[model samples]
Target: MPHFHFHSVRLVKALLACAMLLASYAGAAEKLANVTILATGGTIAGSGASSTTTVGYTAATVGVERLIAAVPELAKVAQVKGEQVFQIASENMSDAYWLTLAKRVNVLLAQPDVDGIVITHGTDTLEETAYFLNLTVKSKKPVVLVGAMRPGTALSADGPINLYNAVLLAASQDAVGKGVLVAMNDQIHGARDVSKTNTSTPDSFKTPELGMLGYIQGNKPYFYHVSTRKHTADTEFDVSKIDTLPQVDIVYGYANVNPVALNALVAAGAKGIIHAGVGDGSLAAKVTPSLTAARKQGVLIVRASRVGQGIVARNGEANDDELDFVAADTLNPQKARILLMLALTRTSDSKQIQRMFYSY
Candidate 1:
C-alpha cells in the first residue's frame, strides 16, 4: 500500500509540472518588450480635489514613485521604472531645459539595458518637446512622448492609458526607427507634425498635414507608417551648444496690421523675426517698413502664414522681393521660430537660412 501511494504521488507531480510549463509558454507570447519611463512632472502626475476636475488640477500631487504604484499593471507589460527629473509646468520650459532633456534621452537610449524610453511631459508644451526630441535623439529603438490634458485625479483622467499605450509602443519592435512619437487620446501622432488643437477636448492632438501614424486598442498599439523626419543619427542638428537661442518674435497680420511690434523686437536685439502674414503668407502693408528696417539691421527675417496650413513663399506677392525674407515652407510660425533659432546657431546668412527652411 505504501509503494502504491508513492507511485500515485509521482504521477500527480508530473501532471502539475506539465500544466505549469504550458501556462508559462502562453504567458510569454503576449508579454511585452523592455521599456523605460522617464517622468518629468506634468498633468500626468497632477491631482484634483476630487475625480471631477481635470484641467483645474494641480501638478504637484503625485511623485514618480507613487505614480508607479498607482498603476501596478504596468509591470505586466514591461520592466518599467520611473525617475523624477523635474516637476514644473511645461509652459515654463526653456532652451536650457530642452538641452538637459535631450541629453538625458541620449544617455538612456545608448544604454544596452534600456530598449525604449517614454517622457511624461505637460500638454501645454508637449508638442514642442516632442519635436525637440524628434530632432535631437538618434535611436533605432522607439522613443515616445506622452502628456495628459486632464490630471490623473480627474473624472476622466487620460494619463494612465496614454502612458500605457506610449510605453507599449516604446517596447514594441515594430516601433523602432519610427522617430519620436506622441500618443494621446488613443491616437499615435508623429512628433514633428503633431499639434494640440483643443484645450479642453480629450481628442485634441492632430497632425495638420499628416494623419495619425497609428492607434491604440486594448492596450495594444498598431502602426501604419514610419516617421520620415530628418532627425537623430541622420541630421546634424545639435542642442548642447545652444546656450542662448536667437530671439525670434511673431508679427500677426490683421485687416489693419502694424509693424510696431516687429520694429521694437528688432531694436530690442532680436536676432530673427517671423512675420505672420495674411492670406497665403502675404506681409501686411504696415509690417513692411519694420520688416525692411529689420533687414537693414542685418536681422534674419522669416515669413510664415497666419493660416495654420500650407507653405509660405517669398516674392509671391507684389513688392515682396524688395523685402527679402525667408519663406517658411509648410512650417507653422512657431516651428519656423525654432528652425530660425537653430539655423542662426551655425550661420547668419539669409541664403543659408533659406536653404535650411527648404531642406529641414
Candidate 2:
C-alpha cells in the first residue's frame, strides 16, 4: 500500500510540471507585440520587367499581403498583419488620402490589441506624409514610415530589409511618444526633420541639421535622441473631424524671378503661398510687391529656403511682421505646407500661424 501511494504522488508531480511548461510557452507567445503594417503603395511595392531595372518601373504593383509574405522574418519580431490602405505611388498621394490614412491610423491605434503601426510609402513624398501624421495623429503609439528607393523586383531590392527594420522599430517600447519616425537603411529619423536628399538611392532619406534619432541593429532598436517639437497626442493639430485640407501652393524663387507665378497661384484661389526663396528665405526685390499684394488680399504667405538646411528666421532677413508674412522656420516648403494646412483649419491669423510654426 505504501509503495502504491508513493508512485501516485510522483505521478501527480509529473503532471503539474507538464502543465507549468505549457503555460510558460503560452505566456511567451502572448508577449509578442501586435504590429500592423499599413501599406500605401510605393517603390517598396514596385516591380520591373528585369531584376536590374531600377528606374522607369511600375510602382505600387505589389500588395500588402505579398510584401508581408516576402519577409517571413517579420513574424519573429511581432504578430504582423498587413492592410492595404491605398495602392498608388506616394507622389500621387493626395489630401483626401492623407485624411483617410490619418483616420485609419487613429482608429487602429485605439484598439487595445494593436501595439504599434508601420506604414509603407513611396520615398518621393514620404516625408510630407510623415510630418503630416506627426502633427495630427492623436495617439502616442509608435508610427514608423518606411520606403525603398529601388523597386522590390530589383536584384538587390532594399524593401524587405527596410520593412523588417520598420516593424522592429514600431514594436519597440522606446519608440512610443517619439513622434512619427522614418526608418530606412537601418537609420531612424524624426519625421519633422527628415527629407529625401537624393533623387535615387537606398540612403536617400536624411535629416541634415538635426541628425538621426536612432538606428536598428540586429532587429533591435537603439534610440539616441528624442524630438523636442510637439507631436502625436501632444500636438494641437487633429485630423479626426477634418475632411479637406486647405489649398496651399509652393512658388520657387530664382534669379530673374517673375511675379506671374505668384499672381497666378493667387488667381487660382490658393489660400496660402510658400515662397521657396534662394537664400535665408529671401524674396527678390522684384517679387516682393506681388507677395505684399497677395498678403494684403487675405492670402497667407510663408517664406522657406530652397537651401535645404538653415532656418528662415522671423524678422531676420525679411521683415515678416511688416509684410504680414510668416517664416517657415526650420521646416522645408513641403512640410511648411502641411503645417499651414492644419493651421488654417484652426485660424488664419498670421500671429497664430507663426506661433504654430515655431511650436510645431
Candidate 3:
C-alpha cells in the first residue's frame, strides 16, 4: 500500500509540472502594448563625422526605421512601429509642426490598437513641444518625449538607452493618465515643469520646482508622484480644430536693455509678448515703457523669469495688475510663449489670461 501511495504522488507531481509549463507558454504569448514611435528628428537621429566627434555633426540624418532597428531589445518590451512625422533639428520646430504633431497624437490614441506613443525630438526645443502636447493632447494613454544629448554615432551615445527607456515608459500601464512625460537619463519628468538645465549632458532635463514623477530601474518604471496640475483629458486647451496657433514672441531682458526687440515684435503683429525678465520676472525700468506701450497696443504681455528655477510671483515683483499683464507663475519664457499662444485662442483679457496661466 505504501509503494502504491508513492507512485500516485509522483504522478500528481508530473501533472502539476505540465500545467505550469502550459501557463508559462500562455503568459509569454500575451500581446504586448503597441507603442507608436513618432520620430520628429533630433540629436537622437544625428550622425557625427566620426564616432569620436560629438559637436559640429549633422543632425536629423537617421530615419525612424533606423532608430527602431538600432534598438532590437524593444521587441521584447512592446510592439513598436516607427513613423517619421518630419525630420529637422528641433531648433527649427515651429507652431505648424506643433499643431501637426498634436493632431497626429490624438488620432493615434483614438485607435483601438495603439496603446501609447513615443516622440523622438531634439533637446533644444524638446521641453516646449512636450509642454504643448501636455496641454493639447486629450487622451489618457501615455505620450513620452525623448531626446539624446549626444549624436547617435558618438561613442557611448545616449540615444539607444533613452529611446529604450522611452518605449518602456510608454508601454507601462503606470504611465497612463500622467500627462505628457519627458524621459531622459532614466528619469521621468512631467512636461509642464521639466526643462533643459544643462547645455550638453545626458542628465540635462529636470523639473526644478515639483521634481520628477519617477525613474526607470531594472527596465521597470517606478512612480513616486502624479502631477497635480491639470493635463491630458483634464486640460482646457484643445488642438482638434486648431490649424494655426497665434503669433507670440519672447524678449530677453538685460542691463541697459533696449526695447528694439520688443518694438519689432509688436510691429510684426505679435499677439502676445513673453518678457524673459532678469529676476522674479522683473523688467528693467528702461524697458517698462516699451512693454506698457505694447500692452496698450492690445498685445498680451506675460512676465517670465530667465532664471532657471523658482516661481515668478504674481503682483509682487512685476506690477501685473497695473500694466494689465499676466505673470507666468512657474513657467519659463519659452514655455510661457506656448501657453500664451493657446490662451489667446480663448480670451485676450489679461485677467482671464492670468487665470489661464495660474490654472494651466
In candidate 2 the C-alpha lDDT for residue 337 amounts to: 92
lDDT of each: 0.80, 0.94, 0.93
Over 23-67, each residue of candidate 2 has an lDDT whose tens digit, in order, gives 998887888899999999999999998999999999999999999
Writing each residue's lDDT as its tens digit, candidate 1 over 1-360 gives: 999999999999999999999989777854656677888888888888888886577875578788777778777778887877778778787777877888888888889888899988888888888877776786777889988888888886888888878888888787788888899988889887788899877888998676789887887888886655576566567766556667777778788776677767788898998877777788666677778888888888888888888767667753445666788877777778877887888889888788787766
Kindly report which residue stretches of model 2 are placed more than 4 angstroms away from their true locations once superposed. 1-22
In terms of TM-score, how similar is model 2 to the real structure?
Answer: 0.95
Question: TM-score: which candidate is best?
Answer: 2
Flag regions of model 3 displaced more than 4 Å.
Answer: 1-20
Pairs clashing in candidate 2? none
| 1 versus 3: better lDDT goes to | 3
Off by over 4 Å in 1: 1-32, 318-322
List per-candidate RMSD values in Å: 4.0, 2.0, 2.1
| Candidates in descending TM-score order | 2, 3, 1
How do the residues 20-95 of candidate 3 rate in per-residue lDDT, one tens digit apiece? 9998877775678999999999899999989987788888999999999999999989999999999999999999
